[model samples]
Target: SLANAEKSQLEKELEAEKEEVETLRDNLRNRDKMMKDRIAMEESNRQEAERRMGGMSKKQMQSMEERAKSAEEEVEKSRKLVAEMRMAYTVALVQSRFLRKAMEKLNLITGVTKTENQSLSLRLSNAQKDLNKMEEETLNLKEELAKTKEKVAEAEEKVTHMKELVETMEEGIEER
Candidate 1:
């Protein structure tokens, strides 16, 4: 049950990570396409302005040039943003790989720890059994010791009675 819980949690995390990676990739691709389209549109607008400028006044020409310069600046900014986004995507990819590897190692460690715990549990059970057996043996030994003590007490009583009879016989012999 512990293994299953851990595995499911890890799976959820991995799935979430994969989703994040996919989202980043999609965003990068969309941004790249938008940048390309913006650049192409800017180029088309510049060409159209040049074609119209042939009959335009000096001030109008200067305004047209300023607008083109502004558009170019916007394109440059977009390119830089795309570059930064690409770098972020790369970093995310690397982080995902590392996380996957870490998860795998964690799984392995968890499995090993579970096996070790089971082994320790078995050993503890065996030790308990051995302790119970030893306790039983101790109880039997105590019972035998008690019985031997009682026998010794009975033998001592008999020896005392025999000694008294011998003393009486010697007294009788002296009197005679």
Candidate 2:
């Protein structure tokens, strides 16, 4: 009688714990789905914003400006969602790691572990390279703009000098 009662109580506790795990799994799944959708939408919006940043007609600029603002807002939302998801994922991963450690202690099989360390490292290296390229591009654009401005100022100075010479010649003729 005592052994059967203990077994029933243990089964009830196990069932409750299983339900809790399932709930957390469901939450993690939903968060992941939302994160993926938001990232995809934001990627498109970001591309549009980048295109708008390039040269355009005045009217086109005005339209792009309005769209850019809206897209920026969307990107902000996406960033926030991504941040929340990253936090959630970190927490979940930590929990899973703890559970795996516990299972190891209890002599149970461990869940799958990441085996793509090299792949991850390579991707990060590539991302760094892309960042460097963008930085160089921005620097080149700034230098070009500075040179163009200097040329415009030089042209303006030349025009002013010509106007002064014309006035001086006209005054000499008047005096003669």
Candidate 3:
């Protein structure tokens, strides 16, 4: 019974582990998607900023250049963030693959255990049948034994009656 409980616990643990791994994968995908969206938004903003700088005077142009430099720095930061997101996605992919392999191994082990349990159950059923058959045969043999004992007792009684008859016949001959 303890072993059965342990097996059930292990199955629940495996299912929970699988669900956790899937949740991690989904979170990683969502983060990567959000990072890409942010990068795209930053690129669009940089383009719009450049278009605004196109119609400015000299002083305005210098100020625009400064602003453009800042935008470039921000864009660079966004790029770094994207790169980190990519790396994280890669790591999550690898981890997901590892988890899937582990799940497969667990499934294989569970299958083998089920097969073995079925085999043992069949063996036990066969043994029980054999035992039942032997018990029936023993009952039959006991009945036969009782009948043989009765027959032996009858034969012994017949032998005793024959002895008495023989003695009476001999005694009568002696009297004559």
Candidate 4:
């Protein structure tokens, strides 16, 4: 019963962990999509800036460069965030796998132990029955032994009385 309870608890926890992992995976996928979109937008903006550079005034060009630099920095930041999220997701996945394996092993061990315990219990019961039977046989043998001793004692007493009578008869005949 304890093993079953533990197995149920482990299964519940494993289910929760799997759900959490799925949620993390979804979040990671969303972040990846966003990162890809931002990268594409930044590339498009860079191409537009290049096209406008031909007739642009000095100040305009400077402003465009600054804006492009800012966008690049933002893209870089987004890349870093994506990378971090991926790492987190990977870690969560690894943890979930480890927990699953551990739970499986625990279940296996519990099953084996339950089987062994049942077998041992059965063997103990059989041994107890055998001991009871042997005890009963011992009691019967003791009673029979007592009866045989009584008969042997009676036979010995009769033989002793007969020997005494024979001796007395011999003496009386010799005296006559």
Judging by lDDT, tell me the better candidate of 1 and 3. Answer: 1
Q: What do the candidate models score in CA lDDT, each in turn?
A: 0.50, 0.43, 0.46, 0.50
Q: What lDDT does candidate 4 reach at residue 11?
A: 53
Model 2, C-alpha of 16: deviation from truth (Å): 0.8
* Number of clashes found in candidate 1: 0
Model 4 per-residue lDDT tens digits across residues 1-176: 77656655755665565465446545545654654565465456546644653454556545554554555465455445545544554555455556555555655566557786575446435544543443343344334334433433443343344344334444544555
lDDT, candidate 3, at 122 = 62
Q: Rank the candidates by TM-score, best first.
A: 1, 4, 3, 2
Off by over 4 Å in 2: 55-176
Write one digit per residue (lDDT tens) for candidate 3, span 90-125: 544454445444444434454346776675456445
**lDDT (tens digit, per residue) of candidate 1 on 1-176:** 67556645755655565565556545545644654565566556556654663355556545544654555455455545545554554555555455455555645565456786575446445544543443343344334334433433443343343334334434444455
The true-structure Cα RMSD of candidate 1 reads 51.6
Q: After superposition, how far is residue 95 of candidate 4 from its true place, in Å?
A: 2.4
Worst 10 residues of 4 by lDDT: 147-156
Please report the TM-score between candidate 4 and the true structure.
Answer: 0.48
| lDDT of model 1 at position 150 | 45
Candidate 4 regions off by >4 Å? 108-176
Q: How many backbone clashes does candidate 3 have?
A: 0
**Superposition TM-score, candidate 1 onto the true structure:** 0.49
Better of 2 and 4 by lDDT: 4
Residue pairs of candidate 3 with colliding backbone atoms: none
